[model samples]
Target chain A: MLKNLLMALFVVMQGAAFAEIAVIVHPSQGAAISQDDISRVFMGRSGDIAGETFIPVNLADSHPAKAHFDQAVLGRSSSQIKAYWSRLVFTGKGTPPKEVGSDSEVLTLVAKNPNIIGYVPLSMVDDSVRVVATF
Target chain B: MQCTKFVWVPALFVASTVSAVDFQYGGFLTVGAGTIIDKKESAYDYEGFNCPCFISDFNTAGLYERGDIGWKQDTRLGLQGTVRFQPGLSLTAQGVARGSDSSVNLEWLYLSYDLTNEITLQVGRKRIPLYYYSDFQDVGLAYIWARPTQALYGWEASNYNGASVRYATFSGHWEIQASAFAGNETVRKSGFARIYDEVNQDIRWRNILGADLEVTRDWFTARVVYLQSDNSITDKPDSADFSRPADKQRVFGLALNADFNDWLILSEFNTNTRKSRDEELSIPAPAMSVGVGRRIGAWTPFINYARFWEKSKDADYENERFIDLSATLRYDITSSSAFKFQINRFSDRSEFQFVGATTLLSANYNLVF
Candidate 1:
């Protein structure tokens, strides 16, 4: 029984380490997004895409997908991003992206708002939302 | 006096009426103590303080007087509240209390309306964009320095009743922001007494028209600003006192900053002139500062050099000039909190002994909550 429990724990840890994150948008949006575009959107540097208004969504810091997405796509650590936003927030220059708690919640938000772009675990993707990019 | 008591009534009313919207309350605090290590007397005593003293602002005057460690100079608390009525509209109010002022003061009360994704219009009182850090100078957690170099940040009035229109746009790997503002202010008792023989006088800046532009491409940023105003002064117009004739004021400023994740560089230069027929009454002040820092994990160590000079050649005017060399270390206790220790070496180079050479040591714990 103990051996079985150890094997189960190892498998869970391995799965978490190899989890994939996907950047998603509403199905109606068809614009292509590059890594630089993703970075700009998440960093509050971009206000729109092709003259269409859009907003970025973020996962809570405690979520494992958040760390993976920030490192793989945004090219910054969680702390670095926080510090960057601190400068903007205090200066009244910009506000960080709105945050949600779970992948399912992110899927719901993205599916409902064509103007929002978000990230979730690749396994959470469905027909309701379109995958813009994945990492 | 009665008018001052009603300043927050409108804000309170609006906040109360918006029960469904999100209301955010945030604040920042800095408790700092420093001492001037000077042993000799100098002409800085004109402001009733010893040489080597640092003045952060006109009201928060007299810091680190010779041989004294006190928290009354740079310590301050600021509170800000925001009520968002919807996606593109909001009201923000900010108040600050400094150890120097002993009373709470409203620093910002503005309504912001987003006309488009890239344009915003703000109406109400705001900080004058005289320098790069003028907008968030009170938030210590936002910058690495123990304080923005006082030599350059010092000004007679920092706030004005104004309206500003701002435009921001981002291109591939580049971002630009531009602003145009107009405003006026009347300080009943001028807080800047050091330049006027330590006598409190009423001061006014009328028809203030200014523009600021900033551009950033990746790690580098540059800014330029220009402003012009008409100035007037009186000892106390309503109390039967002397008055100084109005004059013309013009200012120009520039700043460049670079951040390479772990390495940082900050620089700014500014020149301002008040012109009048009376040479003694005319003032020309120019200042500059440069800083470099590197981050090692959660710790950042930095050094800065700043200089300010009075360029007016009037024989009747008291000449003032000083240079400051500072070394600072910052430790981030958390994402929103930091501890800083700094040492400053100040030197006087004026024809008149308005300031004397001295050393200062200071420390502060700053946090935003």
Candidate 2:
């Protein structure tokens, strides 16, 4: 039968080349994060983690889990995070992190914002968010 | 003039169509070209430009003369816009459009705010933060150099009218940032005094004050800066004879960077001075730049070196040096575009041989959208 549809399309392309990714938040948010506070809140340089005021979100630069969350949590590449946010968005100094489009739209904007934060693909996490780190 | 500085870009799009702001908008472009594939013939003559020229932008005196190529010495086109209005205030504006003076100026028009989540508070007319890529030097897809190093990035007043504050945090894994500023400027027809008087000159700096600091870890970074000012000039056919008054100036800077995920490094150093309220003239002026690169995927190639010298101990002041060397490659071409190719040389060890020794051969394409 066409070799079982080419072994079911090579196991769904090897499970999307070894999926993984996670990092969500908002199951009534409980602060605790590190990997350098999610790489300084996805490189807009901190917007809190233990001082509360979170709100990072992104995954739409042609999402492939945004190139595996920009090479596993912003170690860069996606053209160096688009040249580091084009030098902080042409120098008004910073503003980058607010993009959505998939993984159920970042699990419905991190299950309806409790100070949002996002990332997905650990088999599209469920239970209304709260994974808080994985790469 | 320049449509009254863009009449606030159609009044910020009619105040973001009557309230509930947001706006956004972006842009950037380069499309460059160059020429002067080598030269040496010197006999001094800057005010009439020609004879191996190559100023490639000294605060927009962007020359390159020496026949052919030359798409306005590094084309341009910016745009930017912000708006926001809530969640911590905002309102930016930018406008560019150059091809060397086919006009359309009004760079940045600040207003940021966000006084917490680690400080920030800007005011108006920015750029003059003086190096470390002077706050996104026209965003050539955020640099890999197709330009930068016009011997220490020349300036005579690249905007200022400011009030700044910025602060960013993350201690213990480093990544700090700081700034403080106060400004004034006047520039009127001073493309750095038309490379030395042709006519319309006029420059000032006045009360300006400054500060800077930067830090980073994980592939190192460092920076420092300081400044002070009160300079002056005005000629407009007043036929120079020598007398520049309000001089007090001071500056100091430093930078160091590294990347290491495919090797890269960049450096800078500066010194300025200027005294002379007739204390038998002081002058000073030192500069430096360094670069290196190596990323081979979407290409990257780089190399650079720069200098500027000019120390004077008054023996009748005459120094003014120069040096530059470049070699770029870049490529990316997506993720917001890029495509470079350079090859510069410049030398001109100065003793009034102003824009002499040259070499150049550029190309660019940069973009942002």
Candidate 3:
């Protein structure tokens, strides 16, 4: 019985370590997006894709999906990204992405606006918004 | 403090009466203290200040004398309000209280219009971007330095009544932003009191026009600017004047920056020339600064070197030169706040030294809300 309990704990740990994140866009967004494209969009470096402007939505600061997305795709820590956006905001150079509280809120908003893009845990992906890439 | 109260009273009154959705507010603060550790007196004493003073600008900010840890030199607070009554149009006003100035000042009050997704126009008072850090100098959380290299970033008049057109665009991996501005400014009480013999002077810049271009690609960025103005100086109590001509002043500046995630590099060079037929008045002033930093987790440590040379063509005028070396450490307390400590060494290289060689120790806590 003890051996069976240890086996269950190892499986849970492995699942947590390898959790998947999905980059989502409006259902009408049909163009392919690479990881670089997603990074640029979230960093305020690019505003358009396929000759149309798009708004990048973000999860709240403490979200687990945000931590995973920032490290795995954006190649930056949360603190570094926050500081980067702070410089731009105070200089009137750019505004940061609008933040929602949870995965479902992001999905709901992206579903309504063709110009909005967002990210969530892969398990939360549904038919309302299209998943462009997954990591 | 009275000035601050006077300005905030009306601002707060307006905010309370207005619809909350139309108005948004933000602010920033920096509390700093510093002291000089020099043992030698200055060779040439400035009007009221004793040496070995840490002269950030000859007479403006960072004026540290011996034996006193003073907070009044760099501490400051700023409040900003934006009113958005319509889409693509907004009005923004910013008020700042400086410890050195001992009064509240209107730093930016402008109406901005978004012509399109990528173009903007602004009119009213705004910061004159003479250096890379000039526009956001008051927002300490935006920069890594405890203070920007003063030798290259100093200016008597930092704002103007102006109109500007800005365009931003991206092509593949390259991003470009360019702007053209025209404006004029008048400073009634000169900030450069030491150079003006302790008398109140009126400095004016007329027919001011300038253009700035910035380009960025990945980790590298570069900026270049040019400005021209008709400069004049007159005594305030009495109308004694300095000789002036149209297009009497011209300035050129360049900056290059690189940020490779963990590594950062910044450099800027500028030259200002007074155009006069008389060789005595046709002097050129040049300044340069270079800095590098490394980020390790939440802390960044940096070093900077800066120099300024005031070379006069006339035989009777003495050239003044100074160099500064600084080491700074910035630790982020949170995403919007930071604590910084810096040590600076200033060396006077001119024959007649106004501020002798000195060392300064300074620290600051900065926050944005």
Candidate 4:
């Protein structure tokens, strides 16, 4: 009885957790990209995507969406990711995606920049940016 | 270099009253004490306590405490960038001084240039790719009570000066990354003894040149490190070589790490060999360490066994072994800081000339801006 109860709770709780993040871009973006391409864009570690000049934008460190984006999209801890990026930044070898604040801010920026890709909460979804992937 | 200025710099000023990038920092501090349980006697004169905490000082020849224990501090303060920088280019650096060192040496300075989709060209004086912990061994960031046995197999200088080129390939469930480095190495050792007015005693091995490589794939990472130096080490024994040509020495190491979710296992074996007449006259030294750790939520507990052996034509030459352990727990109170605590034990088997066996225990509080 206890095992079944625990399993039910686990399943119910899993439903509440998000599985993927929506990678949004300005409505102006017409590029038909791939899944691997999307991962590269968000990791900020990628140099190019499908030959198109695209830039990945990150949410501010403290934003709630940042957590969803990290686990659902980036698949890393905030600390591990930062350690990963500092290795690039301090050396002048690479720059990560641009960072913006708030779901509304990211949506507005994506709605405006054709080459920009960002993430936001599902509720904030709108016509300004397209959902590139569930994650 | 064109859009070089901080892109996130303006975001801080435009946002709220307190900017994340403005740099606010604080850290926790913990101290502890412990006792030496066992020892073998040698005229070398040294300490052999295996408590890994930073608090205990001065190596006692060979003394054991019945239930000996004391304060432990794994405390650290740091600065973390909150605004977040662009992916292609960024700037970062850190300074830490939690132990006996007077100040935090410049830990990392480099330019990470993404050459292609998979290759990253990082050039500058960053941590030498010696072993896994070689990268984040700082007390402020390292989550382990003590570094893994494979990384600190021996008492080796932790950092190197040089540029590293790293490449990585990622697929669905698998990932691979490799790094190679070319850099200058520096190390120091010093001691003094006095005889009658006409006689004086001094001994030391001050510095060297080194390089190392690391490669990793899903669940496994391997590393090799080499350090070479001439007798030109910064300090020389006063009674010895005033003009004697410096001798050459090499430290070679190899290790592997395996991670299966919350449980991670690691092993390392290394040997330090010196090639010079002076070395032969002194001793052939080699060291090894093996350790394992597990992560539970924000807390992790680990244990390691290490030994450093030195051989000279002289028999009763001193060889020492150390046992270390600690439980480290951290709860990320926020994005820039975390609360941490550590318990440790250090011990030595034989007291070699001047090198005594002692024990230490500590707790650490760390803060990052």
Give one digit per residue, the lDDT tens place, for model 4 in B276-298: 56534455566666667775655
Per-model TM values vs. the true structure: 0.84, 0.36, 0.87, 0.68
Model 4 has a DockQ score of: 0.20
lDDT for each residue of candidate 1 in B1-369, tens digit (9 for 90 to 100): 001112322332353345445566667888888887666666447456665565545544545677678787779898887777776688888899988776788988988889997899999988888899888888887787888887788766778898999999976567899999999987766666544446667677888899999999878999999988887777543543424556788999999999887898999999988887444467788999999999887889999999998888777777678898999999988656889999989887777655468788889998876
Q: For model 1, what is the alpha-carbon lDDT of residue B354?
A: 56
- lDDT winner among the candidates? 2
Clash list (residue pairs), candidate 1? none
Provide the overall lDDT of each model, using Cα atoms, as 2-decimal numbers. 0.79, 0.80, 0.79, 0.50
RMSD of 3: 6.1
Computed on C-alphas against the true complex, the DockQ of each candidate is: 0.23, 0.26, 0.27, 0.20
Clashing pairs in 2: B57-B62
Once superposed on the true structure, which residue ranges of model 1 sit more than 4 Å away at CA? A1-21, A27-30, A50-52, A61-72, A75-80, A102-104, A120-131, B1-22, B39-44, B194-197, B236-242, B279-282
- The fnat scores of all predictions, in order, read 0.22, 0.61, 0.36, 0.08
Considering summed lDDT, which 10 consecutive residues are worst modelled in model 2 chain A?
A97-106
Model 4 chain A: worst 10 consecutive residues (lDDT sum): A86-95
Per-residue lDDT of model 2, residues B1-369, tens digit only:
011122232332253346545667777889899898755555655778775788888887888877667897788988888887765788888888888887788888989898886798999988878778887888887779898886777878877888899888877788889888998988778787788777867788978899999898989998988888888887557544224568888889898989896889898999888887966589888999988999887889989888998888788778889888888999996777889999888888877657888888898898887
Interface RMSD of each: 10.4, 11.8, 8.7, 6.4
Candidate 1 chain B has its poorest 10 consecutive residues by lDDT at B1-10
